[model samples]
Target: MNHMKRVLFALPLLVMASSAFAAGLAVTNNSGLPIDELFASPAGKGAFGANLMEGIKEGALDDGKTATISELASGTYDLKISAPDEGVLCTIKDVKVDGAALTLTAEQGKACK
Candidate 1:
């Protein structure tokens, strides 16, 4: 019975700790172009993760608009923004995300080859 109580007490702490490591990112498109796709990966990782724009209802984030990406963990990341027929617009490197939410602007992206 004592062990069961201890386990129950620890369960909520575990849940809170797990949640603290994962967070949502709010990206604002202020680059003067529509963003058709968005991808994020851990910093220094060669490959980008799945397209984050697929979760948006409009299928894209237009200039001056904001969208929330809910699948990120608290850490540094690289962001890739692309447009249909325009290829990759830019890539933003070393973006730090922490806690429950972090906001970023697309205008910070740099030209990529």
Candidate 2:
């Protein structure tokens, strides 16, 4: 290959390499309550969104609340709800997000117990 041809070929490859990146998830809460905490990692992401009117704390999560999570990776996650200031409550539920939306509702009695 000529010098000019080589340079042109290499330029495209470099651009492609930089643009390639891993996937990511977006966490949103519209349950009319404040989510305690959200857990996300390179492996995947877990979300806990819910309404606090039903015995749930406003702008906070008490014992149990409404929650919904999505965009979880293809693995296992120890998911729980927290107050973000007072730590966690209820129990740590073992959740699985297989590269799709995993809708979850905060529960008191879980299988982990």
- Cα distance off (Å), candidate 2, residue 37: 1.1
Q: Give one digit per residue, the lDDT tens place, for model 1 in 13-50.
A: 99998875554566677766678887888888958978
The Cα local distance difference test for each model comes to 0.71, 0.43
User: Residues 30-112, candidate 2, lDDT per residue (tens digit)?
Assistant: 32324465543332344543322233234443343433333355666655544434433433446555654444443422322
**Model 2 alpha-carbon drift over 4 Å, by segment:** 1-23, 26-33, 40-72, 84-88, 106-113
Superposed Cα deviation of residue 54, candidate 2 (Å): 26
TM-score of each: 0.62, 0.34
